[model samples]
Target: MKKIEYGMDFVARNLGIFKCPVCGRSFEKIVHKSVSCDQGHLFDFSKKGTLYFLKHGVKSDYNDETMWQARRNVLQAGLFQPIVDEISSFLSENRSLRIIDAGCGEGSTLKYFENKRESNKDIYVGFDISKRAINLATQGEGSAFFCIADLAQLPFAANSFDAIIDMFSPSAYGEFERILKKGGILFKVIPNENYLIELRHMLYEKNDNHYSYSNAEVLSLFKQHYPQARVKRINYEFTLKETSFEDLLYMTPLHWGAAETKIDDALATGLAKITVDVLLLMVEND
Candidate 1:
């Protein structure tokens, strides 16, 4: 089947969850090739089978295909498998769920989670500001829906989702609080100091300030938002092949500001073992 037809079927199944980003009116039904709200705001499904929900086009640093492909490679290699396992086990307790992956880039992690669990009662929907990211996400094998939308201006109704997954992405806490159903959990993942330490050390060997990093402020801000939230610290290392190491370098933003020579040196040296230290914050909406 064509992507639009498949996308239309998914949309029709989950129609009640969506709201117009412009008018904040709930969508009633699919109108031919598009979904419309009471205000007549129309959103068309792209030929790629994903919906475009952004009111205006936005530029993103992650709009490149190479970066997303590298990310896909890293994920498929099972680097973040532990984290995915933890989340899937926690989610398995629920009989059914409606999950929206906030800032879900390329949709690999969301797809991974859906695959890990036993229940087919979950509805997986992912949205990213980068159109390229969503496009890449839709190409993958999964029943999860993908769309182009901003995190801050989420195109959904209040109290809509059972859980919101924020993986290494900026938090729109207020928007998150607005959309989550009461008691719904928010699973947030943030990097610890050792995350990609080898890359950081290589990229900034001489710069002490750049070599050292901290997540104090990030943790503090998350606590401020969810005073009663629980946190899980996960620390581990994964061995990567030479090609996977190259993919890691390109996939991460660590080298975005580093010198070309530094990147080349790191690539030449090659990273065999990499750390995956990170924090998992879980909070329930009251």
Candidate 2:
């Protein structure tokens, strides 16, 4: 009898959805460290236990080692606990469902959820376009599976996942619809208009227009896909720890165009806390 690899058992048991990224065909079998389709397109699983599905033109701002480390640090500091709590409360009570996080950078959010519901015996998978993020995401493994793939062109068979959690990440509605099982849920988190008013006022010229985040387009898409979707805002404020202020500055894309002098000035000001606001849009596939 052939020996089963450590993670292959899990995939063979519950993840038949692991499709070929190159040919968009379902994999027939796993052999000698690689999953293959009939066309011989091999998706190799690394020794570290992660599968890379993005083959070409892979680019991401979160690709750098330092950037992923900084994100992990910020998440470990409990910066998004409240947000997580709010998001988790909205999850369905069904425990056997297969859940995957789209664009799961560093995999912190999925890990947090898995840890919270460890006794549920559910399957948790996190996928990202950035190999660096997926590499760091493999450190923890309590029912968590990590993969490198683009959300836009997911490497999974149709009707694969029971739920897709898309927090602060891009969405491929077409792909999501194709991969989600009937009656599956899509939990999307989007930044609120006043998500970071204080930081913006500090680093750049004040423009209410810029700070106002309209979800008209997002909602339109949501309705197009899941006509019976719900949207709600989760807003709160927490005093910033001076220690994490620098991490916060660098971790966010808001400051990408800001001058160094302004960022330093914002840090020097010692302003404490900022509003944390986001919208949770729940859509279902019927």
Question: Which candidate ranks first by lDDT, i.e. highest?
Answer: 1
Residue-wise C-alpha lDDT for candidate 1, range 18-137, written one tens digit per residue: 899888999988898999998888998888878888777787788878899998889888889999888766674647788889889888888887787636568888998888888889
CA lDDT, candidate 2, residue 18: 76
| Candidate 1 whole-model C-alpha lDDT, 0 to 1 | 0.87
Candidate 2 C-alpha error for residue 233, in Å: 0.9
Q: How many clashing residue pairs are found in candidate 2? A: 1
For residue 264, give model 2's deviation from the true position in Å.
Answer: 1.4
Off by over 4 Å in 1: none
lDDT of 2 by residue, 1-286 (tens): 1122555665666557778878877788777887778888877778767787777766666677776777788787776778888777766665667889998988888888888777777788889888888878876555577888877788888998888999888889999889899988888888876787778777776564444456678767777877778888888886767337777666677766787998889878855787788888887888
In model 2, the worst 10-residue window by lDDT is 1-10
Output the TM-score of candidate 1: 0.96
User: What's the TM-score of each model vs. the native?
Assistant: 0.96, 0.89
